[model samples]
Target: MVLQGLTVLNQKNYEISQSIGKNLFDNINEGGFDYVISECQTCKWQIDMSSNVTCIHPLTLLCMSMDA
Candidate 1:
């Protein structure tokens, strides 16, 4: 299962997703997440005022266990 998932990850072109695919997958599976976050700062000053989108942070286990 891991190998198949890894293969899919390898085919991806996104730098962030490819680098952290395993962790993202695990988070979704274990925590039942519906979306993944890919945050890159374009500028130091940032302000998020929109309320239409929802953010769900995966549990620590999902992020940490990705290495295993």
Candidate 2:
């Protein structure tokens, strides 16, 4: 059987998921999530994106994660 749940990992594992289109399959609007976060490997920065938007990050990245 296929178990369905959100699984978040470190930067390395996150990238692997991105490559395999794992992030594409997530249903962001179906849960208690304001946004999902992932860190940029190249810039050493984190980003938060909602279903209605991309990771523009007008607010602080550290603060966003704290709320999550």
Candidate 3:
């Protein structure tokens, strides 16, 4: 599943945003996927900031795959 522009954070509600972000991060980690691909810069930043897994941009991954 591609979550291209998943906005997990809610700037209006800090506590709720943190809770949602944590849940999302935990679920993603538990899924054991090798890569998290996203097109949105903010999404990438959020994922990276919250979890050990690094999110890669779709175009970057595509270029990498082509090279491989």
Instruction: Give, for candidate 2, the lowest lDDT window spanning 10 residues.
Output: 41-50
lDDT by residue (tens digit), candidate 3, 1-68: 32333334455554555565777889778888887888888778877886778899999999999999
The per-prediction tally of clashing pairs is: 0, 0, 0
Misplaced by over 4 Å in model 2 are 1-24, 41-50, 53-59, 64-68
Rank by lDDT, highest first.
3, 2, 1
Worst 10 residues of 1 by lDDT: 42-51
lDDT against true structure, model 1: 0.35
Tens digit per residue, CA lDDT, model 1, 1-68 = 12232233343633443344454444445665444342322110110111122333345437756978
Give Cα distance to truth, residue 1, candidate 2, Å: 19
Better candidate number, 2 or 3, judged by lDDT: 3
For residue 35, model 3's alpha carbon misses the true position, in angstroms, by: 1.6
Looking at candidate 3, what is the lDDT of residue 32? 84
lDDT of each: 0.35, 0.39, 0.72
lDDT of 3 at 29: 82
